[model samples]
Target: MSDTQAGQIGEDDHGHPAASKARLRLWLKLLKATKHVEAELRENLRTAFDTTLPRFDVMAALYRAESGLKMSELSSVLRVSNGNVTGIVDRLVDDGVLVRVPVDHDRRATTVRLTNAGREQFAAMAARHEAWIDEMLGGIDTSEIRAMTDQLERIASTNAKREG
Candidate 1:
């Protein structure tokens, strides 16, 4: 393979180099891989579940911990703003897929949990989600996936530390 063809200096339609390229080619590949994964998940969630990705994401979190999640807690876990959570939750609540329950003794506090139907739907979609991730990782073997996961975790930890 040519030097530029070795995953660096990707050429454009006019045989020109990418306009704005990163020196770290590996990071660029990683970003592209992440976007691919997200796009696949979004399409799958839409077709298989007829649910928007973000709303499904919220429900998936609650489905994992069936007891419930506070609005603030879900916001933190989803890494989204409270207003965004409010919009998603409102739709879910209206559809009877989720319920907002009052905190046992603290009237002001509330938690969100999937309703029976929501739990059932989440269970089905969760299975498909797993399958989709597996299919997306088709070329890679088990060992490679583990190694990639470790490297990503390391990168994430470094960035988190840097931001902190």
Candidate 2:
């Protein structure tokens, strides 16, 4: 069947048109919701903290690690390239919120950790972030939220299995 026919109202030889269209609509809705939430978060971080999402993400990762993470490890955890992470790390280091310590027995490697001030700052941001998320998703009840979470997890698991 043609692409247009596949998206039309009736079934073709392959599968039910209604089911395919429903799945397509679901995918679009999911994408829209994700983008909307991400844009709101990016704006919130910028306006409230005068910080970008990338910087917040770097700090968050380090905050969770406590002892900090190596530069390469940070990049890996963030799923970003080393070059992309370097610029954010550089700015954080200059801001005195993050410190770089030379790794033992490794001349070319360094680990990044948040300073005392950085930890305090992140804690405030994290609390606010949680509230923001709660507020945005407040329309959904607890059970619905749990159900949706489980469904999304299933989708992720399916995709992981396919890829692996």
Top model number, TM-score: 2
Give per-model TM-scores. 0.81, 0.88
Worst 10 residues of 2 by lDDT: 3-12
Question: Model 2 residue 62 lDDT?
Answer: 100
The list of candidate 2 runs beyond 4 A from truth reads 1-16
User: lDDT by residue for model 1 over 47-73, one digit each (tens)?
Assistant: 877888898899989998789999999
State the RMSD for candidate 2: 5.0
Give each model's whole-structure lDDT: 0.88, 0.93
**Model 2: per-residue lDDT, tens digit, 84-162?**
9999999999999999999999999999999999999999999999999999999999999989999999999999999
Error of 2 at 56 (Å): 0.8
Candidate 1 has its poorest 10 consecutive residues by lDDT at 15-24
- Highest lDDT scorer: 2
lDDT of 2 at 115: 99
